[model samples]
Target: MFEELSQYLGWTNCFPEGESFLVIAEGTDCGFILQHFIHTFLKRKLPVCLVSTSQTFSHYSQAGIKIGANLDKAREEKSIHLVDLMSKFLNHYTGQIECDWNAKNIYLSIKEELDSMEISANSILIVDDISVLSSLCLSIDDIGNLLHYLHALSKQRGFNILMSIPSLDCEQVQDTQSIAEHYADTVLCVKSLQTGYSKEVHGQIEVVKGGRSNCGVRQYKLSDKNLHLFARGTSMAVL
Candidate 1:
């Protein structure tokens, strides 16, 4: 789905082992970035785990279908796990491994499940959006602690985690988001397309923190079905 994006960013071999990343983007665009990342991981036949906070399993399944990611098959094959926390958001229990709606509970459940699978190391964990946790009225300290624990887990095991959050915000939410970014090994920021000359492109992704050397802004096109990436004509490196 993102052949060009992968080529442009050299992502095919960029994400090193055991690295954790933070992705921040505008609404809708966040979904595209996550889908693109998931596609890349699936190509490598790696174990993918998702902790959904804003959407149900079905929504992501449909999205994965568009990218030729047979999520249902992946689940049956145990190649992927969707640890959903949006049960309440979906009006009932939806998590494959149900747990309380708090971060501690979610973390404990995931850790236990991964341990049982014996593939806790060398895996990927994708979080839909952290801001939704703020909406749950979780304190900033609680959010920070959660991030710290997740970060430590990633290091202990040889796994990577890619989390998404909104870049623009105010108040306590902003504080939590900032701390999350700080814990990440790499950071990506996606914003609405800045160039006015092209309608095919929807936005650009910036490497806000640690990333492969020479990583910079690249024009991206996000639609209802796919995400496309193009090299920039000029050097507008976010660094």
Candidate 2:
């Protein structure tokens, strides 16, 4: 699965150069999958920037620390950066909606981050669950504009941006998915399926759009540490 994903992203060798990817995982553990993909496949030091509504940076941070602890080349090889837009914006608010002032502040902060990283060619931006942000304050069009801005920044800087959305949030899901389909270079959708009468599992990944050939739907498995993909015939347990 990693090989196919690497191929989809136009990665010719172990390290991919100058390509951006967006993956939408259906559930809460999307961050885990993202971290695993970067660490296991890239196996080199690259700049990774995660923009999320979620508070925990533990996954990537731990990966970095582990790699650093072992003094592995892969650890020293890549740099991990995180931007918590949700926490930054909603820290003051006790509720869901963010005021106009807060929203502007969040946007400014993200803009500043992008400006600072403009020179790195291999940088990656992971926007985990855009639906959370849209639900909090921004309208559909506003979110669209934000996505467009990010897309432009990725292209101009030659970096990749990975954005995730919930499949259940139909409205925001569609809106976010559309932005990705139209502007993103690649789109990966991770979902679940019922294999038979007795078993229901979370183990399917499909490339809905972007790039050349479709890898079709394949089986995926998630553990505490990594998200593994299987060939067409393999079976796995659900989360």
Candidate 3:
């Protein structure tokens, strides 16, 4: 689904073990980025534990189908494990299950899911849009502590972590996002073009690996079966 993006980013090898990967989606949906990671890791036959905070399992399954990765089949095969926080939250709201929707409980649940997975260097943990925790009335401290715990877990288990968050206005949210970025080995910042939407390009992605010293920006357009990456300032519409 993201072969061009992967090749451009030199993801020939799996992501470095035990590193945090952050993606900040601003003015655009970064679902494709998350999907890319899942598809890539699963294609490599690596175990993936996806923590879906904002979307349901079925939502991802449908997206996976479009990308040629059958998430439902993967789950049946135990190749992918899902921590469906969205369903948990919904059940709690509808008086179905007594779920303590706090950061501690969430962290413990995620830890439990990761524990159930076959831990190895090739394992990948993907968290879709962590900032949604704020909507559950979690404090900034709670979010910070959650990230710290996840990072520690990754280090102890030797698996890479991937997380995405929308660019937000609240200072507290931004602080939490910054903390994630500081801990990240690679950060992908996705933002809309100033000139607004174009048939040629959807948005720009600024890739920061290790640090800002190593950064590259690319324009991209999303399709049903591909993510077309363009060199900075170039457009495929003309061709």
Which candidate number maximizes lDDT? 3
Of 2 and 3, the candidate ahead on TM-score is: 3
- Give the range of the ten consecutive residues with the poorest summed lDDT in model 2: 66-75
Question: What is the TM-score of candidate 2?
Answer: 0.74
Query: In order, what is each prediction's RMSD in angstroms?
Result: 4.6, 4.9, 1.7
Task: Assess candidate 3 and give its TM-score to the true structure.
Answer: 0.94
Residue-level lDDT of model 3, residues 109-187, one tens digit each, is 9999888888888689999988888777778888888898898889888899999999989877788798898779888
Tell me the tens digit of each residue's lDDT in model 2 across 1-239: 24444554445564544455667666434554565455643454555665767646654566545433221333344344556666656664765754563345556667676665534666667776676765665777777777777777677777766777666657776776777667756677766554532232345777755464366776665544334566656664332
In candidate 1 the C-alpha lDDT for residue 183 amounts to 84
What are the models' TM-scores?
0.83, 0.74, 0.94
Global local distance difference test of model 1: 0.72
lDDT (tens digit, per residue) of candidate 1 on 51-93: 8888877887899887678878887887878776677545533
In order, candidate lDDTs are 0.72, 0.59, 0.85
